[model samples]
Target: MAVSYSFVAFFNSISSSYSSSFSKPSLGSLKPHYGLRVDSKNSSRRLVLSCSSSHMDSNSDTMDIGQTQVSSTAPFGLTMSEANMSRSSCKWQRVLLKVSGEALAGDRAQNIDPKVTMSIAREVAAVTRLGIEVAIVVGGGNIFRGSSWAGSSGLDRSSADYIGMLATVMNAIFLQATMESIGIPTRVQTAFRMSEVAEPYIRRRAVRHLEKGRVVIFAAGTGNPFFTTDTAAALRCAEINAEVVLKATNVDGVFDDDPRTNPNARLLDTLTYQEVTSKDLSVMDMTAITLCQENNIPVVVFNLSNPGNISRAIKGERVGTLIGGTRNSMAART
Candidate 1:
């Protein structure tokens, strides 16, 4: 009878052990020590283990349990660090970047400077790295300024402007080649048809290029005899549905007066489209400002000489003078 009792007791102990092993909560399903219940359906055991391991490793040096809880607030797929990193990385998906012909003249008397071209290319590449779609409208003043030359030589204004437009094409070729050299895909589109040299400007094609993250350089101005490249920039901005128009210039931002000539000149951080037109600010041509105002496109005037400003502007930073409708005020209030 005593031996039988001993056997029964042993069997009972074995059953209890098996039951405990099976019933014990899985670490993944384990509720927080507090009242919080773990969402087991949404997360797997492997993910919980990985997260726990990472948390432990991250706090190995410092035994801060609160940090781990803070890290857990993020969803299952991304850690707190990854979420913050993504927020910082977010940039404008579409932007129209206007680069003047004079900007292409990097320390040169006339025409395209290779160094300047490469510098601008590097800046553009940096923005593209952040996944921003960039469309460029280049001016032809570096190679030829129609107004100045026409005034001196008595050339017809329309003909001189056409010559200026052609100059932009040359700049576009140089820019395209430079950008391609740095492994960035580029497309050169001209308003004036030159099928052998470049694709004719097509609204759909330009939008497609931007969607694919390719740099679209619009050249030959509006293809009209009288329109300036500034006007072209505005037109492209609307067509491409860009969030903002980034006008890169020699000056960093718009000043109340010529900063170089007047030491007391104040840099305007923001201006309304109406104010720019009313004051007749010489930052962009009057026609360009009018188009931007009518279309409700924001214009950011920044210095191209400083590296990384273009990327900064596209990221929605206040690095330059912002000109547009009062719509931004409502956005800020929210």
Candidate 2:
């Protein structure tokens, strides 16, 4: 019995979730903001190269490693207020959700706080039930950061990055378990091949999964070293042609300064892609932001702490900072 129990625990730790793009808006209606900085042509070319190599290569969760497939229709039971009755009527049909690993860590010393994971799972669950196709790209900072790990250890950067990629796979497995437990049908696809744990990420296959209303989780980072998960999120967003990339962070929204340290920091409700790149906001890496700019895909940076904020953003209720092209461009689309 003890051996059997140990085997179950081992399976639960790693083999949990096995699961699971961008449209361009017109540029003519772009509303120029006060300050605009163009992304360097060099950076643009670099991004294109990074994405191109990925066509040559590729691109989470849980303890729920049970053999039984969870039912997708299980009641997530997210209450929508009458004020937000059209919550299901999202502005975009599909989106890529970028969740940081630190957010999943919560207050724990070890990686992954179960409560936070569950909360996020429920948020995704609610969105899936609302009929918006949800695809997720999760980071592994809570468990391991390749750069940091390399800095701390004497290991080479490339080796550390490979280990970090594995950490992302672990996170994907854990999330899969948590989401499945909530009755959401989740699929985990990896940039690197992990035949036993997840499906190899095929762009068309990922899109089909989204169309079928399955929440697809993207793990591993570009199947190559020296690439951050933010880049992975941006790449996946473009590949799948998602309407937007919703980056869920701990703080409420983008601010002039670090909200944690500066009492005077003010939340920004909206920002242009050019402004973000020019100002070098901590929202995401330059590569990720540049890709969004190139594709004209809006990114909503919001607080995952607030329950139901995902639904709010999707419903266009304005809960976080909306980053995209000129206001005129956005307005024309609406």
Candidate 3:
């Protein structure tokens, strides 16, 4: 059997120091807050109506109820509106969006086009407002391609790759600025340490930021040479346990052939990881594909030029090609 105790009684029994911090509210004023389990016996429990003071009185020895600062009402400190939105509309709780640097150029000669960046920012912001957690991995091909630039610049391949990583940092900071302009909170985390500018990549910290409704941007392409941002995105996705990887590109989706070169190339709506590797498809680099395949993470390849595609992908709509682990499964069914 279990014994029932009033909130005031329980506090007094435990320690007199907490008595002032928690007040026993009237039965009519009780809110549906969380409960405290004091009884150890296996038996039914009852609610205790206790409310915290609006402001905690200064106490050196007494501590706050939750040291982690997580909300009692909502998980991850999400606002009530965001929590409701997530519960009602979100198909994927967490998502990783991969944007190629060239897509941000958007037919402009400039390496980073403001108009294109804003367009992408707006879409991402809208999706975020829907209470979905979004992490972005942006490429740097618009500013530099290490493999190609190394041959012409007479620099070592490793040096060129480092420069390319810096370019990704630039793009990440640029996108962060754009997202912030519209009242979205963001954090730029680099793989390698650059504490003067951005936070170094920490798995738990990044996950906490995502839970708090702040978008996290991963830069520096895994902090290594010879690894594309695609691989970085896959690695980040796996580390963060994101549900799917949204690969935003200029084309609608993966095609049987190079769409730009082959006029009659057909867009493949769905593909398995094995089929992609077997056919030598260009969905992503083989390393990235293998990483995602090993982890059973699905990759959604879609057009960034089209508005609402990002949101559609989050909703699991039929907007683009889905590369999943299953064989012969269509996007609509998957």
Best by lDDT: 3
Name the Cα RMSD for model 2.
24.5
lDDT of each: 0.78, 0.77, 0.83
Ranking by lDDT: 3, 1, 2
lDDT of 1: 0.78
**Tens digits of per-residue lDDT for model 3 on 1-334?**
6556686687666544333224443443433433243322321452233333433334413323434444535434567666676756656879999999989888867999998889988898877776789999999999988988886657988999999999999999999999899878999999999999999999999999999889999999999998999999999999999989999999999899987889999988889999999999988999999999999999999999988898888877787798993323233522
What's the CA error at residue 103 for candidate 2, in Å?
A: 0.4
Candidate 1 residues 1-334, lDDT tens each?
A: 3568888898778557544533563544433221122233442321222122212233423232323544444332455576456545645578899999988886666577888889888888876655567999999999887877775667888888889998999999999999999888999999989899889999999999877769999999999877889999999899889878899988878999988899999988889988888898898889999899888888989888887788777767667688973323312310
> Ten-residue segment with the worst summed lDDT in candidate 3?
34-43
Q: Tell me the TM-score of model 2.
A: 0.71
> In candidate 1, how many Å is residue 30 off?
47
Which of candidates 1 and 3 reaches a greater lDDT?
3
